[model samples]
Target chain A: MYVQRNRSLSIRSRRDPPANRHRFSISTFRGMQQPELSRKMGKMIKSENSAIGAYEAAGRERSSIAAQLSDWGESTDDDTVSDISDKLGVMLAEMGELEDVFAQNLEDYRGVLKQIRNMESSVQPSREQRQKVTDEISKLKYKDPTSARLETLEHELVRAEAQNLVAEAQLSNITRQKLKEAFDIHLAAVVERSEKQTIIARHARRLLTFIDDSPVVPGDARPAYDHETEARQVLEDAENDLRGWAPSVEPIPTSAGQESRVNGVEHDSDGLTTGLGSATGAGVSQPMTNGGPSAKKQLEEPQSQSQTEAEPIAY
Target chain B: MYVQRNRSLSIRSRRDPPANRHRFSISTFRGMQQPELSRKMGKMIKSENSAIGAYEAAGRERSSIAAQLSDWGESTDDDTVSDISDKLGVMLAEMGELEDVFAQNLEDYRGVLKQIRNMESSVQPSREQRQKVTDEISKLKYKDPTSARLETLEHELVRAEAQNLVAEAQLSNITRQKLKEAFDIHLAAVVERSEKQTIIARHARRLLTFIDDSPVVPGDARPAYDHETEARQVLEDAENDLRGWAPSVEPIPTSAGQESRVNGVEHDSDGLTTGLGSATGAGVSQPMTNGGPSAKKQLEEPQSQSQTEAEPIAY
Candidate 1:
């Protein structure tokens, strides 16, 4: 019976190996039968290799072209040609490096394919042995309370999934934060630069307007000077006159219940004469107090003169 | 000869009576022949008026819709329906307003057209008078040594043209400045708002992460505590823990070659350090003195352990 069992086991092993081993055997048989497939694979590999070689050849050709372009002895416009040639040379070098990387990637892919094949072969077991292993696994399952283990694993899986979700959310939040900060910083910089440009443009426009509106001729005494120079001098003089005016040196009144002195007398909101006393003490003359009547007469005289003279220019 | 000329002028005047006059004149006769054209123009105006009315009606409807959508009552629900309704209202309102503006523009165009027609008719001198004026102008052109008045007018024209060119250039510069300023203000406001929002979002995310990672069981925690509060507490705790252990303070050297005291630092560009020495003191305890080393070690150990444990959790 032992001899029969042993023979039966051997026969079973011969008939059906482990699943992975069967797969490997089947693949091996398929490979042997279909030489065309191997040939096609080999052709693909050769084409890939040739493509890499072609890339390298192209790189070399580009390098040669660059070298020829850079040959100052052969060309009179060396500076321009050499600059272009140098750029091309750098590009060619980069292309060569890219080709190398591509070749390496292809080799790595080939190795991974080989490893996958090996794994497939290694996973295959004899049919009888597989059956025995399945029976043993069933027996173990019956003896052990696998439901508890499965429940634990399921719980752990849920926890892990929740953790993963949290982590992903956090990562996304961080990325968004970084992007927002960068955008804000960029925007601020842009706004600042634009503001500076705007100010410069405004000043330039003011200068242009001043130049455009300036009088063509100065006073009769300085009529011999060029119009632009005279205008500029007039502007300079006006500016100097303005600068020469002294700021008030009088101390501000600190009297109790008195309104604060801002340049001159401060008026109440009601448009009344509440703050008139403060101005009297200061040396500064108040137009409202002394020149009120005469100023009004002067203003009317100008208006009458303007109205009379207006019609003469109309025709 | 004068009597003959007067008779001819009177005859011409009688033949070409103004349109406003009761009697028909040659010019008025020409205008009367274009009755069909006038009718067509009237019909066009009527159609335009109707179109404008329709546009105004549409505008009113859209404006009402927009007002309703933008009202405080509509913003209560943070749902898709409310959003869609608001968007639709805005679009309808915009469309209506655009229609109204279009109608107004058409009316304005019609008014301009009528004004142009009136100007043309008013400026159209009688044919005989126009000929006489042309003859006089030609005579003036043939006069020796052009009139001083004409010379002055020509100079004025040249000056006006130069002024126009300068004004145009100045206007363009001003426009550029205004555009730049507007853009800068807008960008600055946007940057400031965006930065605030980013900071808020970052804080929000950090709070969320803290809440999610807290060791306290959700069920065990106080049921009255809201998510926001819980998150805030977690953040506060984390901050306190960091403050207690982390040495983020840095020492800034004073200009007097004296050590400056700094405490309660938040973050430094380099690694954390302790306080600077006192101005007059020597052998002052710098960083890594007393509890510094132990605190750092304690902080580092837990962090490393947590990181190691987090690796598998991450995967």
Candidate 2:
């Protein structure tokens, strides 16, 4: 029972720089090819995918372990261990279910982040176009002061600058708005998970108390386990708590009003939404709703399991 | 924004029997090789390893994502987003560190289970020995009624029965005691993780509020980002809350007093603690102390980072 616990932060955290995680992989090469303006957000979006996958994997493993635990308990042939472990298995499985739900919430958050990355990717080309035309006009002026092509190039530069201006504005607006929306869902999911899991784990501890660890001598038999009713009650309490659970997070406010978006376009002569993909200020003109249904929506939604099942141990 | 969430319990839960997870793997073959008495606990211990590994992988990914987030924000060139994202990264990295600690705690719980498995494995041989002797004596009587080998085998049967009885008692005592001890650490770890993450996540939500998600017009600049003081305060608050955090779980009681173990031996005429390996009642008779420094000990331990560091963003 000599356990060497990892008391310090992991060595991997200290030695491996987080900025260059999995840098040699094919995905990293794709990331490297991204336009400079969009590179960082692109990388963050991809890393978020890995983060979500890890959570999904963790949830799957947790559920598998829960079932194995109950099966092991039944095999023990000891009545008390069998009953308590089976009940503990039920609680653990619920915890696994929570992990899966949390991962789903994170996936929503990841999608919101993708909006920003997509906007970044679109904006990069406009920025390059503006820079290219500006460079050409300057070069013509220096090389041939009287060249008629200089006037045409100057006009093209104005058009490119106007397009780039709209793109830049869309990028800034979407980036700020989506970033807030994403983490709002993310942090709320975190709090929801912590609260619900605390409720389950607390009840789970009660199940542990039912196990009588008193030792017995050779030939002495343990008394019959009669805690079945009490153990079953623990599962009932957990289910009720989960069913009653609600989001207790603070409301994250936003000011992305309709005026700043659509009016910003109609009022500004250069802020034409034409020529840009639908990504340009598409939703900005609308009133800021809780984008992508906040974690609160999921909590308020009814659970899939039937409320009429009187027995807690249906499985 | 169409989020098709897994609101229902996963389909895998309904169709895939928990009893046969990964049954075709090489590890499953190893599990099958275990003696019948120890097989179930053996499988359980292995599943716990996968569960712990999943958490470790999750922790690593989370920390990586946190750094990437901060890097992405810094590249945005918006002072407010940059400062807030960096602080948010710090909180997230802390959460990741908690996952690693939780995984470590599970490893301790897994170690405790191995003790029960080892005891079960040792006891299996004794049970087989007794059964073999009884069979031999019966077969000899049926085949050759006058065989002198029957008397020697009967004496061997008595000796085997005595050894087996001791072995059975040891198995039950160790199983119950260690099962309680193992989950005591485990459930406590769950509670510890839930409570601490709630603290960090609440503070992280505060960081999110500092993000000015107000949209801007085309060519209109955002106000100079100015939430630095408030943002840094959130980190300090989180660190302070974490440092002050403690275990508030209900204490699980154990009746594994010294008398039931040692006196159960001294008082029983048949309870000779011999023949079995030291696994038999070695430490059972000793006073029952908390096993493997429950989650409380780790909570009390000082963190690796120095309290004297005034700057929160040293990295």
Candidate 3:
């Protein structure tokens, strides 16, 4: 089958003259371009392949870590240090894998971008070629004398121009589609990889917490918290803030015909209010209109006083 | 104003005792019999709160790590030990927070389950009590004459039975609703947390990959591949399959007379073919009869093989 295909291709190539054979020559030129195109495509594919490989490797790393962690979870031993170390190692490995994939993807993106640039450069006409083509068309118009022949030539030119326009439009569309696909693929890969990182970070944080909460070896060289825990906490805090829960506050009362204001009076000159008398006497009656530092200070004074009084009661 | 509010609350408590008060007293009496129920609600609340806290903390940890890692990401420095250590520390801290929250939530869940059991025990009547009630009703029926007083007592009994039924149904409904709500909340939290974990894992993997690919310090530890990646890839592959991707053999040529045989062949292989291939080759002509594993495998094998070959050629 392969031999037959090659023979057919060779025969097809040699049967026609190079200049007169429009179909063969055009196709041959296209065929010749194929290898270069394939090479470029191959480079892109290779980069993508490597990126995917890195991605797979990273994924495997993460999965193994997950399995290990799960295994550790089921075990009865409290040798958290070893377990945590294993987890940390797994997390670190996973993180490294994620980074590898990310970097590879970036390289792939760059490769794609380079290919695009090359294609654009190759496709564009030089200034001299543009002028020559324009001049030739005009000269053809001047030389033609037979009205029918001129009309025919004009018709052919019009058709060619239309075809060229159509081809250009199609090419642009394809380019656009390819570009979009490339971008989308890159984005998807990045998102997927980033998401994995997030999981490792979370697990790592959990592991760290497990380690921290339990009593540590008296003179162990390990620090109080590991990198994973810190990273997890930071991410957690950011996420929490994003979800809107950094500070706790009582619901602001809203009532018709009553101006909403924070009540701030320091009758006791402390910062805390515990008993009903203090809460009602001045605190509830005096409403602070502003939320400036002075108001905050005033609020703090009463709270401090209240705290002093409350502390003794608590004791 | 606060004093007045307190006074009002006290008056209200005296007039129409707080539901919580009744609940508390009931809990105390039933504590020995149904200690679980008394603690369940509180435990559920506590668990929910802790889970939320853990989620928030994890988010924070991620953000902090992201910030720190961001710097490292841009740096071309080789000594990533310090950076790694720093990040590990953060992750550990975050993990600590997460574990604390998870532990709290787990405890709360246990408490809630205990409470549910307690409630179940409380709601059920002892066998002796049920017998006594049955006997009392029967006795009343026997003693009652065909008179106005007997009719009234019978009516009262009927009304009491109906009330009991309604109350029981309502209690069941309330319990069900509470359980559903608790489950939903817990499930949602679990899912959210799991997703976050996935994200962190993905990010961690990417980071790891990046580190692996990059020219970091020679002694710097390289991360390993884990199962998370495999699971994700498998999931993605399954999804793709669902979207539409499967292999099948071309059907055998059938003559007018052999149509019945063809139908039989289809019936036999119906179980082998999933929905994926059904949509694409719905009306295509077949060249073979029943497709066993070999035929199906033959058809399937080329796709992956061709894909592999085509990939390199494209690049």
Candidate 4:
């Protein structure tokens, strides 16, 4: 066998991109562009890989925080501290969801890649069949001194063409565009999910610091008011005043709202129960607010008030 | 065109993983176990894709925060607010670094995939050539296709075998294990980096809240006393006594460290101001220890004061 060891059924790419990748044509694969596409897609693959690792790490970090709460002597009987810890528990669960999403994102990415490999390999058998038919055609043309078989050779040519077409059809099965759609779609979702998750982590941090640095004792009888709630209301009222911005979700934290928020709050101020919300000072003054997205905007409390404010003061 | 339209070069997979994936036996390509492998690798690809999305999101989120800082009024002067704003700027820079790393990771992942596709495609030419040779040998068996032709056919079979060996060698160029190794290495690094970043975000949150909640006095000649500095040191010393741990880094925030922190502190306490360092307290504390890597451990403070303490007093 005079083996042509490197015959290929290659796809070509041009700068303009194929009009339709799945609809295979002679021009569909301009050359071999998977290398370039794969190289570009590599960033997506690596990013998802990072996310999986980060999600798992974040879960472990949150768990360590739970341990920290115990080590820091977070009085379990103190409703405020315990409340924050419970909310942290909820954030931890959200991290678990993020991990699952990350896993799915990875699967979808590799799934498309493996499909590409399989489709590319599909060319081998067709090329082999063509070679065999070509040889049969050649045999039919050869005479062993007397009998040449042109009919059989013509038949074999037909077979060869059929095999070639089969290979071409498989090439039509996928396009570069389709591969990106399959994989990159999930990537966008995961990215959005991750930023949301970081906010949850921020909430967890605020809750931890508030519980840790607070000097006020938990009220024995009366329900101690959390200034974060009142401040958020004031901010919402301010937002309505500033831009007529109606909050998409109600800003009020009902007792059930606090209990049921598995993913924590979109805003971090909900977790800050410290006098940071409403410090009355100098002349028992009020709060301060500057302009920005109220999500990150926080009001200033008078230092003189934060200084001598009653611990666990009612809003 | 009597095309066998749906003929497939499919790999057959039993539940038990086709013996070994790397052993390039003829049976290695049996029917095609691609669906199974694709199903498994899908997770990996999806994960990488998600990471890419998340890395971008994180970068964008950091940029938005920078915008928020500006919008919230980062004046050049106010030392306290501007100091926190400057630290936020450093964090934004770190986010940029993370985005770059994510891009590199994506490229590596896609590079491996493209290589795999290229290697798999290499099988086509050899298989086609072998088919042609086999047909030529068949033709040589005609009436006067004599012993001489048989000798030629025998030689051709040997060449076919050589081509088969080449195809097998091509198979060895890529293995499932190699793909995993190529893509998974960065995942570990990325994960560790993310958790470290969460801690960064935590510190950023604390600094922000500290600035936002404090009165906007640009320290007009009278030394500004931060109640938080006192409270945090007291907590640290309390923790030190509780764990019999000595402070590895000073908890007091020196303005010098702020001017100097290229990579922030190992412990948050080390970043606290010195004035809050030695607040005498009534100590009612007992120590607790737990076994773990203890990445954030502090060395012990003197235990003489922790035996009897008041609970929640102002500095």
Candidate 5:
């Protein structure tokens, strides 16, 4: 309800003009061109780029307004107004600088999101290859059950499945790890911006108090402003407070890639793992949650290494 | 220095491409058309409008990204990522809405600044009139010392000086009052936005902890996600914290027009004060700071009221 009251203060009754609602641009075309798997992330990243641009523009305009305020105050020729407005201008300019800094932090978060998008793009080809091999084998078998090429198609299917298995595992590993890492940077940035802006605004309010707004009568000159020293002191106090400010946010903890069983799973010369075929032949079934011990054992045994080397992926 | 390290994380080495630097629009033209006295405030107000627009655009983009994040998570077919990103989207959307509310608060502050600009516009004419009268009086006196029009010209000069005096006092009163009032709203809005966003981001980070990023080897699936309920609870907690949020800002105090000596000064039929001519004639001078008691005494006496009613200004 408090927020509702604030929103009601907008001079324009609408949120934005209807004509400006949809402006399809080059970025949307780029998002459409991305692989299906990475499309969503690509779009999100692009939208984030626009959001960062807005903040940068906002910061630039805010700093400009601060200078304008100081210039207007000097033109007034009232000593008190000039002194207080100039000091207030300094505080406002610092707030604009904070916006620029906040935008930079968001840029860091955006980079982490790009990693997720890149992983998504890399995983798409493996999925298509697996689907393609299965479809080909099914069509070939249905067309001729007596063909010698059936054996070759069957061999291709097995290799494709093995490669797909490795790809899926890598996908799962990277997706979860990068997702956590990205938001860790994002949420922390939010906290940092909030804390620093609050500090600047509180000190800026102190400058407003130095202004004496008691009205003067016509033909009666107001007393010469004696708060010049005090107004300057407020600016100094704001500077000191800003200099002493430090982040006070709780850090998010993560154990993303440490102690990874896949870290010990040996790969052949082509960076292809044969764990799927050999582990299945040995009937080395383990619960997904409790696979750590058996995986460690497999890491020690030399048999699993040779099996992976025998079935190098074709594509 | 600490902020410097964060800035280095930006993927783009440059701030923005040179092409996007300047874009001229109708607002700048409107600013240029304003009268000289109010031109600076006019431009500042226009710049603030653009800054508010930037924030609104940022908010819209942010909310879109939040939805995209949720959609991308669901497409991953990872239940853990789905639950967490959806809830994270909820928090991010709320942060976007905060930006909209902040822009509204800024519109209120911008309205207060307009009051000062309006007062400045109204005072400009009185300054020109006074200057014009003094110029004419000097020209006629120099051309003919004993001209018959000398008495009338001097009288007109006196009237112009009195009107300008009243206008100057009114300008001073309005300028200080509105400036203080405007920034009071502005700074408090900053504090409100900061405190609320911090609350949301802190709870959102808790959801990240629910994501299990431990890597899985090929041929071994990730364990079924067991933190669905915990992730859902994090969203509820964020909403509850936001609902309970309150403004935590120190109030800025102002005494703009209260105890105004000008408040008691009588105006003639045309709403013009004649205090200058008669206050001088009566030799009722007092220091501006100590004029309050004497002003109260003047209010009790009927003579000052009649004296103010004697001279009516032309324009």
Candidate 6:
């Protein structure tokens, strides 16, 4: 819409009460103090005040009548009351409209206050006064519209409005019930998800219980074998074997043959049996007295042993 | 307060010009003409209209004066204009009060309209009128105070009000700049979080790129023995091994050694080797007679050959 000029017709945001208000005169500023409008304003204020008082009296009467309807005695009946109820419904609508008018009127007057301020500060009697408000605004480090903080805040407001514009609009029309229904619906979804989670937890518990805690297989057969002990033995053997495989920081002579010479436990025959004598490998095929063609056969023969005594001799 | 019964004071919300108004006697309802409230309402209306007109005229005069100031030749000066500005400010405030009065007046008349409707339909001749609003409320399908929807709505409104009570209070004295500052602080937080997420993503990308593309293992020296691949291969192979070990849905014959006999694909020799006899048994110790005591030894010897020529006999 086309507006008057550089300024839109709106109130200047800061305003005090009317007791210190202006007289709307250019002649007074030019040395002629005009008091003509004062009488007019006074008369308006008086009439409006009376109108307000009368309006309030009327409202009190209506409310009083509504309160006393049940005491209307013999005249009160369903049909008559119903007919009046229709009119009451209309009155309620009018009441709502009246409330809106009050709010609108408040806004309009506030606008006028802002308008006066706008004219007071911006309408310069000379060219220099145009810069007055800008200078005043710049003095305020925080409230200045061009401040970095305000710029950042504007970005934030834009994002927030983008997200919650619907919510704000909804708020205007929102009755308590719509808000309840919306939240209750979400609550129900949460409850449903919780219920499913509870079912999942219940099933998991039942599944864990279904598996028996028993000593069964070291491969399903060696059930009689002490598999845990055997496993421990295998771990010990692997650890010892790994240590024998490489020198950590420097070149060192092989250790497996030394183990054989010292511990007398050489039984592996085909591979992983004896060392090649240096840091690297062309692995030696050591001989087994048990006559197994392969070292793996030799390893297996000892793994089946029931006692720890037989474990180190070959494994 | 006691009122003039059916003529309880008010201006009709849709009141026409003062030349025409109420026709309020009971016989008038049956079309007999009556004009009871013209005098009282007329005076109120006349005074209010005059006030409203005066307010507008003052505003127009101020606008006109501001427009004419530059042309006031040598007569206009800042101090003189400042004096008039003061007066304009007062007028602006008065205008605002006048707006409020208008709203109050409207409310008063709406109340009178309700009072008149109440007395006409429900009041007895010898007594004051009783309010029947609650009785009307109880009869409404949607408006009944006890309705579940209304209850839920009320609950929601209460919750919303409670949550927003701080916001409502803060807004009353809040300046635009203050609002901007508060929101700007929040925006900074959002920007910080976004920055953190960017850092997190950058670090994750760098970490993923750290490992070189080339393989670290020399698998040729250790054919059938990729330690890292063996780890992952062990995982894959173990999955396959387990599948081979268990019956899919029924109690069936064991399969490890059986695959060797049936598909002739015998290769692996872990503790998973089997005997297929009954409900349960000792694990299989099937003999390998292709000149290798250990199937693993046989498998490796063939894998080193790599030509795909010796695959069947060894594998």
Any residue pairs clashing in model 1, and if so which? Answer: A16-A127, A17-A125, A17-A126, A17-A127, A18-A125, A18-A126, A19-A125, A20-A123, A20-A124, A21-A124
| Docking model 1 quality class | incorrect
Q: Candidate 5, residue A305: CA error in Å? A: 16
Over 4 Å off, model 3: A1-46, A61-78, A81-151, A173-185, A212-315, B1-315
| Number of colliding residue pairs in model 5 | 0
- Candidate 5 lDDT by residue in tens digits, B173-204: 87887788889899989999999999999889
Predictions' DockQ, in order: 0.01, 0.29, 0.01, 0.01, 0.42, 0.01
User: Which residue pairs come into collision in candidate 5?
Assistant: none
lDDT for B185 (candidate 6): 28
Q: Tens-digit lDDT track for model 2 on A230-278?
A: 9888899999998998888777776554323222332121221223543
Please report the TM-score between candidate 3 and the true structure.
Answer: 0.24
TM-score of each: 0.18, 0.76, 0.24, 0.30, 0.75, 0.16
Instruction: Give candidate 6's whole-model lDDT.
Output: 0.26
Least well predicted 10-residue stretch by lDDT in candidate 5 chain A: A1-10
* lDDT per residue as tens, model 5, A1-315: 001112132234534555756843333454346688888987788788888887877788788899989999999999988988888888888888778877787877787677677666766777787689779878888998788987776666655555555556667777787788778888888888788788878888878877777666665678888987777777788778778877665555555535333433333322212233332223233223222224333332343342232111111
Chain B TM-score of predicted candidate 1 relative to the true chain B: 0.25
Candidate 5, residue B294: how far the Cα is off, in Å: 15
Task: Kindly list the per-residue Cα lDDT of model 4 for residues B26-126, writing each as its tens digit.
Answer: 55554343333222223333334444444444454445444444322233233443444445555544544555555455546544544433333344445
Which rank order by TM-score, best down to worst?
A: 2, 5, 4, 3, 1, 6
Global lDDT of each model? 0.30, 0.70, 0.34, 0.36, 0.69, 0.26
The parts of candidate 2 lying over 4 Å away from their true place are A1-32, A259-275, A278-315, B1-32, B259-275, B278-315
Q: What is the DockQ of candidate 3?
A: 0.01
For model 1 chain B, give the 10-residue run with minimal summed lDDT: B256-265
Error of 5 at A260 (Å): 6.3
